[model samples]
Target: MAIEYLGLSQINGPLVVLEGVQNAAFDEIVEMTVNGNEHRLGRVIEIYNNKAIIQVYEGTEGMALRNTHTRLTGHPMEIGVSESMLGRTFNGIGIPIDGLGDIDADKMLDVNGKPLNPVTREYPRNYIRTGLSAIDGLTTLIRGQKLPIFSGNGLPHDQLAAQIVQQASLGDDTDEKFAIVFAAMGVKYDVADFFRRTFEESGVSDHVAMFINLANDPVVERLITPKVALTLAEYLAFERGMHILVILTDMTSFAEAMREVSSSKGEIPSRKGFPGYLYSELATIYERAGIVKGSKGSVTQIPILTMPNDDITHPIPDLTGYITEGQIVLDRLLQGQSVYPPINVLPSLSRLMKDGIGKGFTREDHQDVANQLFSCYAKVGDARALASVIGEDELSPIDKKYLEFGQAFEHQFVGQDLQENRTILETLNIGWKLLGMLPRKELDRIDTKILDQYYQPADRD
Candidate 1:
């Protein structure tokens, strides 16, 4: 047996230091017999010499150190993995939270699974059609990629996450097969209910699994939520060969939870009083998403977090930007204009987009069209800034046309109903229509041959 019962010598916040044999590994499970009758579970977090520091899973309360006996369970906490996990709701520890009974499965897998090998890593090139033009056209989402969404307070990030879960698809029924693993941390009851209703109404509950750690739950539980979510995702994707999309909403809350736990452990704080290991902690989660070689499945990630005070420079977003492939930025200004997604097309980008859109993937003209649209919109932004100070009347006619393009770009491209899912061709067509408002002489960024083929007649109704 890899366990030994020992009396606790000291209690430090949620951490209980025990004098025992040095046999427990990090994150190993331990059971503490408290007050002779009450039993509590804890995890071995740190080991110094022969002393072990364990974080109580149920919180350390009403326990006397002299009376409590600690026993180490050789293995770490684990959850069952199988097809039955689909459409079910689980807590942070992978226990059923949907009022369903305990899951009975043949095997239990450890929550902290091994990462994919670099030599066996497969390239992620397929597109995940979210039906949002700003994402599809501007920052295309590739299957098995880790793309985070950066939003601000009151920016409808939750709505965007739900829309993706509701509308996300790989391809038609014959070719595409996919599922969603949604994990919400530090959200309110109403928000969780909204997601439940959205999934039920959309008839996707069978293909989507949810693991929620609400705001009122213990802060330490939030630290385990994403790991639990990814564990199931890996099981479904790598083992079952199913394309899985893992959506984690409000990662900032997760970081805050980490900060709280670190504070409880008396660790040094980083920026904004967060833990110093915040970046590495986030990487452990983000790096779990990808395509494994010799497997037909892939795990794509879309982690959403609100920037505190709309500050992208904040540690959470700043660190996230470095770890993930790219980010989709939501604009409060566009939200004020009543745009549904409020995606700021300029700042948003997908680094893996080049591999996902081309002749074999999307279309031959996809790259050129996207570039031209970006260039024209950038010019429009410059024109609008000038017009704000110099007045539209003082600007040249060419600059005035750009100002009009900017207005049409946001209204026609960025703005769309959350329910609408436009095809790739339709999204490209919309871009062409918006560009048609400009004079033909100003179309320098696009090739004349492609322009002749795609450019709609400005006078066409």
Candidate 2:
């Protein structure tokens, strides 16, 4: 259907109220002309009985209410998708940013595409090896899962993201098709530069499609960045039959942008001045990842967000925890100690870990090793805390052994260089070596047959 011209009246802080529009859908694309220049788009957000609230994409700056003309397109915001999108870079709005020529539009997909039906969704059962031992061994990333990485100010979440893009690959040899779509929201120029340099150095830029929204850009642009990136990911994963990994950084920024727009629109505030619909808003993005039954492709997500004041209970991380499968939590304390990954194994978890590890998926001993390690380390942490309160002389010999095991686990097994990508076998071997520091009697979790194959004496030649 052709778009109809709805006269615009009164610009309210980047918002243009449109008259003569009835039943306008949210996220529908509208074009506005200013000073004889026809800007491509605006998005419909709220509608009330023949009147629609539209956010002008190029902003209302230099736009006169009487002079600007508004046309409501029947379609929503969309991105041109094709195999050629790989190896390209786009701005927050899906326009080319890599200095590449305009994209040939073979197909256009709505940014807010429909999600998979509940009954038709397949359980994520395969592993995505990111080569980071802390993740692969402890909080395993299952293919088609929506796992988030929780970090805080001054943490190395960017390095972790780069490592994942550099090393993430499908476990099956038959799946040669894999791609990455990265979206950065409200990031600083230096941070954006670092990502580009890292990708170039790693030589994975060819497989990556990036959409960056800098901090200086209009706050409303950040709101559209992730949706545009995911639109492309869905196209690659479902339409092209390729395994797609979507990496979105600083989701808190995205949420903040939402709050800013909501405030401007006079919506009632929820907790901490955020909109009341924060949970549903985040669900719209996180729920987009999954494997559909009978489709050869899947969309896996790793969304990175910084917890406010290192508080996980903050609305952004809190709401995210409710929607995502699990989180990979970065430890600021460990980072201060110069640990590269700085993953606090205790609080971090992968709810889908059970489906992705052991036997045919990874290795036979994978599950047992992970369980034994977690149990022992947890006990060791308890012993160490007790020792801190009461002197070491008050602890039993077995407790002291556990404390040593916990120390070895963090220093040797959990921590590694940001550039190193250990295979599942290498990660398990490191776990076994740390376990060997304790007496064989403490090895109660693993089967005897598996223990005989992998366990070695700590003092062995």
Candidate 3:
């Protein structure tokens, strides 16, 4: 039997500290009762000597320090899982909120999942097409890779995330068994409603499992939302043999929750007053995505975070960039131009793009075309900056042409309908058309054979 500690020494924020604790384990679930029978759930976060600090999930608003009772459950927080989870809507802590009954659980799994063995982990390969040219043709998302989308305050990352959920796939029908675990933290009611409607209206709701933590909810719950979502995703992927894509939005909120908890616990602060262990703490979640050697399925993660003040150096985005595979950076300047899914291809990259493109994957010319397009777009930026200094009329003929190509690239490539779903072939062909605007002499990135095969000047095409 586990020990029960009565009369906590202190209640601070969402934390409750208990004294004279014996045999208490870290992360053990604790049941707290006050006023005779009022109950709440908490977990042991810190324990040393005879003192234990517990983080109450439901907050400690009205509980007095000397009246609360804590019972250690001798188990870490676990979420019940079953095949019926698909199409269901659950709150941050895995409780169904869609008026549906409890999941007919096949098993109960700990949210703190077991890490994949490094020796048995597989290198991420094969493409996961998001059907967006900016992503598919340039920064391709590979299965088992943890790529993130870095957006700003007003950018349309939510719309972009919704579009990806509706259109993402594992190429052809050979691996169509795909599922999505969409987790949102600290989102407004309207924003949450928008996602729900987008998924339902697109008819992909049945294939998506949603975990939402609203802004009004207790800040402590924000910390548990992503873990619950990833837990469900692991069950769907490794156990049920389905490809699972876990999308976590606004990780800034989750990080803020961590800071709050750390401050409440009187822990030492690091950069920007955030907890010093922020990097390792985030790794515990992001590193959970991958393919194990013997497993037939894979887990790909797309964690979205808004850069505070559009500053990439901010702790949230900076730490994320270090942990994830790559990032899709959304440009606020492009968003101002009324572009939907305004993905700035130059700054965005997918580190595992090489393994997922060429030959049997996307196309033989995908690599070259993407490289050439980047080169041309880079020149366009230079030309535009020069034009601003010395009038466009004074610019060289080639520079003028680059300006034209840049406009065309943004219009036809970077900007697309929210509902647009372009196959890799279509995306590659469109790239060829855009590349045709540039002179053949500048197409140095492409092989001579590829240039000879696909390069057509605007007049010739």
Candidate 4:
């Protein structure tokens, strides 16, 4: 039997305090009726001796302290999940918004999922080709890896994310189902429409599921978007056996929302006014991406966050770097130089790339090509810096060649057409073509055997 109580002790922003509560559990769902006509739903966020503070999904504006009746639902927040979610769009809290009607759910899953056990995880030994040379050639994304894109405001991160969703694949030949689940929190209406339009125009929306929270929606709902997305992803990858790629854009928005909610709750502030538990909160989300032992599917995450003022030391990106496998940093300098992807390969790397690319996974020369490209690109910076001090005409013949190589590198390798989708082999061959511009002795990163086979000294002529 459930007991319904009358009146709220206090209503603070999106939070409501109910005193004299009995048997109220943390994260338990609650139902509220306003004036006995309008109904609303909420969840228990804080529970103490006999009082519970609930966060209402629907904001509390018209409900008076003495006119609302609250009852605990004895369960945490959950959403009805199904394979039908693919190709659909939803609000922050899992409600459909595409006019396609609600999903025919096969089961309901808790939005706050359990932590995956470390013992049951399988090592990632294959790659997901994103087609962009800066990523596919150097920082190759591996299956079940959590690689984040550290971008800045107004730097075209959204465009890069959309291209990856349109072009990502498991390789040339694979008999497996792959899908993308995209979650956007605190985004404007126009930005949300851009993602939908881009996916539809590219004809890849059939395998994409979008969950969006507009800037005008309730602040509390922004907190639920990623959880609802991951919950559905778990169902699809674990139960239905599909390779799931989850792309979460602008996690900075999510962190700011947490700070706002924590302020409303009167909690102590940590770095940048974010709550102290921000690391644990982020870990719960990033840690969810991996391959389980007994399952035939895997979950890979490409969480994109803009660094505040391009500062990697900021709390959001700082903590993220500690948790994720590696980061793909988008450079403002490269973007200004008209590079499409703008990935600064010197700072960007995939730690798991070595295991995923080799004779069996990608190619025999993949590692050597990646290593030499990185070395040559780093030297490009040195040549430019030296030329700025003492003019390019005063440079040695080798330094002049490096200047030419740098120009070609940023233009052809880092930049690609918006619709261009290059294969892994194509990306690697492009690396060889660029490396051919330099002398044979300059390529110190390549093995002598690999050099004898793939390196052509006369190709530069």
Structural similarity to truth (TM-score) of each candidate: 0.95, 0.95, 0.97, 0.97
Which ranges in model 1 have alpha carbons more than 4 Å from their true place?
1-7, 33-40, 61-69
- lDDT winner among the candidates? 4
> Which lDDT tens digits does candidate 3 get at residues 1-461?
66777788887899888999888899998999987689988999999899998998878878997778889888999999987899989888889999988899999999989867799999998889899999999999999999999999988899999999999988874745889999999999999999999999999999899999999888898998899899999999999888899999989989999999999989999998899999998898899899888888899999999998999999988999999998999998889888778888888999999998999888899999999999999999999999999999999988988999999899898888878999999999999998888889988899999999999998772
Instruction: Rank candidates by TM-score, best first.
Output: 4, 3, 2, 1
Enumerate residue pairs that collide in model 4.
none
Write down the lDDT of every candidate, Cα atoms only: 0.87, 0.87, 0.91, 0.91
Can you tell me which runs of candidate 2 are displaced by over 4 Å?
1-7, 22-25, 38-40, 172-175
The parts of candidate 4 lying over 4 Å away from their true place are 35-37, 458-461
Instruction: For model 4, give the 10-residue run with minimal summed lDDT.
Output: 452-461
Q: Show model 3 residue runs off by greater than 4 Å.
A: none
Clashing pairs in 1: none
After superposing all C-alphas onto the true structure, candidate 4 shows an RMSD in angstroms of 1.3
Residue-by-residue lDDT tens digits, candidate 1, 1-461: 55657578899767788885566688888888888889877888998888888888666878777888888888897778777888888876777888888777657888788866788998898788898888988899999899999999888999999999998888553375689999999999999999999999989999998998888776677877898889889988988889999999889999988887899888988899998899999999999999988888999999999999999999999999999999999999889988888998888899999999978787777888788889898998898889899888999988988888888888888888878888888888898898898877777878888888988857778
Q: Rank by lDDT, descending?
A: 4, 3, 2, 1
Cα RMSD to the true fold for all candidates: 2.0, 1.9, 1.4, 1.3
Give lDDT: candidate 2, residue 416. 85
Query: For residue 187, what is the lDDT in candidate 3?
Result: 97
